[model samples]
Target: MLGRTMYALISLSDLENDFINPYDLTTRLNRFVAVEYGAQFVLTAALLFTGKWFLGVAQLLLTAFLLHSWSVRQHVVDATDVFRQLPLQKKRRLIMFGAFLFCFVMVTYRLIESIIHGLLTDEGRETAKKLFQDAAASLHHY
Candidate 1:
């Protein structure tokens, strides 16, 4: 199942890169998967299990690390350009702004993606609901 989802995502991304609209690719994939598998669950039960939070966090951290590396490379390029032509004070300020923007955009994108996925995906939504209910029940019992 994990392989299937990974393949689907990769294929969709490839198609999009090839100028095919993702919506069309997604719809076609959905229909094909539905007919072939009878059901489609993009996220698995394991993904929603409480024990997998660490895995999810790790994945997020890995993605952030990768993006940070790319951002740092871009900053280096920009800084080289600016330092060559701009005043030292102006270059410092621009570098600071670049760092701030990189962190802000990376964090915001991760947060928004997580929230949107939690809202849009059944596994995430169900897991959240189950967690809330369990907490409430535990409180009542107490």
Candidate 2:
């Protein structure tokens, strides 16, 4: 369902650009950006929900970077201004970005810690067992 929604969102962008009168460049760009945002947001959430946390976070980073780069290249609007123009209220924007940053930091820290333990520690096996018990439980008995 999430994947379908994402696909639909992406497709909507193409449809809007092609059929919404190509002469209306600003409208096309706005519609594309909004749909792309929704698609990326859905993909990120889907990846995280399916236990692909790293990929999910990477998708989010890609989304941000893509929007910034696209805005710069297209000269449609400043990337910072795009964010500022979100329909969200000030407090909501703060909380939303804050939560995203917190998750990114924690996930990155845990991944680095795991890597360091695997490479440099004698207790790597035990640490892995303890830290990934929930993940392990999802595996098949075979």
Give the clash total for candidate 2.
Answer: 0
Which parts of model 1 have CA positions greater than 4 angstroms off?
1-86, 121-142
Best candidate, lDDT:
2
Full-model lDDT for every candidate: 0.46, 0.53
lDDT tens digits by residue: candidate 1, 15-92:
535655545544544454433232212122233354546444544443454345446542121322422422432343
RMSD after Cα superposition, model 2: 14.1
How close is every model to the real structure, measured as TM-score? 0.26, 0.33
lDDT of 1 at 31: 52
Residue-by-residue lDDT tens digits, candidate 2, 41-86: 7877897799977667766775675566566663243333534432
Cα RMSD (Å) between model 1 and the true structure? 19.6
Q: lDDT score, residue 132, model 1? A: 78
- What is the clash count for each candidate, in the order shown? 0, 0
